[model samples]
Target: MLKYKILWFLFNLKASLASYRHEVHELGFQKGKKHLKVERIGYLPQQVNESSGLVYLAQDSTLLTHNDSGGAPYIYQIDLSGKLLNTYPISQAKNVDWEDISADEQGNLYIGDIGNNSHQRRDLCIYQVNKKIDAVLQKIPIHYPEKQTVPDAEAMFVAQGSIYVFTKNLDKSGTDLFVRKIGDNADTLQFKSHINLRTPITGAAINPQKNKFVLISYGKIYYFRIIEHQIDFSNPLYCLNFPHKQTESIAFLDENVVIITNEQGEIYRVCEN
Candidate 1:
């Protein structure tokens, strides 16, 4: 057990160092006008060190998050002050690289088990959990059409009865948007569009009104305006410099306020300046 813990520590350290280097390199490109005001709020509980997904529950006024791959299959609920409120366990599902979580209007939460860093996973799927019952409603299997080498993705959002997944694009070329409608069985993801951001996308969140959404990378945040109920990737509403380290999750506190969290358990709140 001690050996495993040591390996985990070393792995985290290596990842942190890489992220720091990327952040440093991005400093030169972020010299323009900063559009968002970011403030450190608090540190999350030690148990949530690798928080990977974030979503705000307006009805309960709480935030729900979960860890990344290799962590237990549990969702941690927390308050705005970064205090752990509760832990909900999903016994029906396995934590095969769970990357992001999204919620629909019908009180159902979608846990994306879609992280494919090796680009060789064939068992990718999404778990739909009914919040009220605290149980998984269905397991939606996902497949990439006409592609054997699947791209990794860590960001997802559910909008207008469909799930939108944005690829991380391990090559740092850009991100591709894929969509799969909510259904009773498995389906193939349809490639929708692409954004030329030249960075890996870590997390994404749509506002309560569903008119806008934001994608977060290690050192940048890209905001898009939803036009005619669709994501408009052509012209971003705002491309702000985030300058954070290993940020993996983001959610909207409201239409204007966004909450971001990294693997180091630091919490940051971003708002338009």
Candidate 2:
């Protein structure tokens, strides 16, 4: 426990320094009005103490989330009010280090077992499950480019039949974006681009419209405009700062409203002010 505490402290220190550098150097372009209204909605069930991934299922009007690393191989279904509605167990999957969850337009859900904190994991993969969440459809193995050290990642989303992954970038001020088609076979993740956000991205979500996306960090929310279905990293719509702790997952309630969850099982809602 003490080791973890020390590691956490160091991580925060590095993140703070990176943010400071970005502000001091004016590294990127952020436009429009600032500030967001954040409200603590409720707390998740005790059983889901380490909620790491979140996705809104509009079909059932419920939210789905899973544990961080080794808790269980089950997904918990809850409502906007934080009430536990049901639990769906992925009978043939292992939790390993489930970091994020995303869904394609067909209602097919994907689980990212891609957490590589030690930067030495080689069996990283994403699990594709049916919308019913009862069975594993496919295990899509993921790998970094040859000779590239693995980095920890917690943010991922699926859009237009493609999966987008953003690395945590704990040691630097930038995150790399990797892309791969939904049904692609086991192969290396293609390095698409990089963004110097000066903070580790913990969660990601594409709004209902598919023209905009948001990435969440410990104390910041980054809104980006997706032009021509391509993520525009050069300009950010909003970089709203807020007070949050260990925020690990995010999902769009709508195009403007977002729901956030932390490791402590607390839920919060953020909307444009």
Candidate 3:
């Protein structure tokens, strides 16, 4: 009798999930209805001109950022107000199109050097470092198994013991999401899914609970909820608008609040209304 009841419960749960996914697919991706007012909270020091990636370090109430390729292979530590605190140099890593940053539960950081603008580079990798700026840098190489043209990715986040990368939709066929185990051998990455965002993706951040994943473009932010270990991207709960044109980086200030940074070194915070 107990086994029968468990089977019935699982069946109902699967049915409900299918129903929800279908409903969202029908609704499609719509423009965010929430008009969030972006408040400029601080100005990044001139040293970080192109703040390509951002991650909020909750332990210290600070932010970690790094510039794009052609810049130093260093990460910048800043306060919530965008004031420069210190710079940690990664002597072993090259800035070859360093596009995004992510951190794990152990407070270790990962820098994605997976940006291939020209779509021809053969080498793609990520740099792992400690949060305290004292550990030795480690390099992990990754190859996209099914990609013919080199993939250009600017957004990445570590979740569920794996690191996921969101590729830029330069091909206009929507973005492809890739995932790989954090400690796995430096092997080819597996394709997770194709996110039909209908727009270019620049940055992304996952909330502390791993329940909400937010992706940002130039003018909008799309929110996705995690369901059964998969992202339900059908109908986003919120589509928040960003006032700036060059919003290249995003980090969650909290469960309901987010902070964005532009290429010109301006910081803005938007909260759910």
Per-candidate Cα lDDT values, in order, are 0.82, 0.83, 0.77
Cα deviation of 266 in candidate 1 (Å)? Answer: 0.5
Q: What is the lDDT of candidate 2?
A: 0.83
For each of the candidates, the C-alpha root-mean-square deviation to the true structure, in angstroms, is: 4.7, 2.4, 12.4
TM-score of 1: 0.87
Write the residue-wise lDDT of candidate 2 on 162-235 in tens digits: 88899988765588888888777747888888887767788999999998899888766788878887864654
lDDT of model 3 at position 210: 79
1-273: candidate 3 lDDT, tens digit per residue: 347324533433333233223224643533344435568899998999989999998988999999987889989999978889999988878898888898989898999898877788888988888867756467888788865687878888888888898887654467788888978985688888776654467798999987888888765577877767785354366554454656779999788788899887899887766
**TM-score ranking, best first:** 2, 1, 3
lDDT string, candidate 1, 115-229, tens digits: 9877889999999999763799999998887886988899999989999999987565678999999983549999898866656788999998888899987767778877788
Candidate 2, which segments miss by more than 4 Å at Cα? 9-35
In lDDT terms, which candidate is top? Answer: 2
TM-score for each prediction?
A: 0.87, 0.91, 0.86
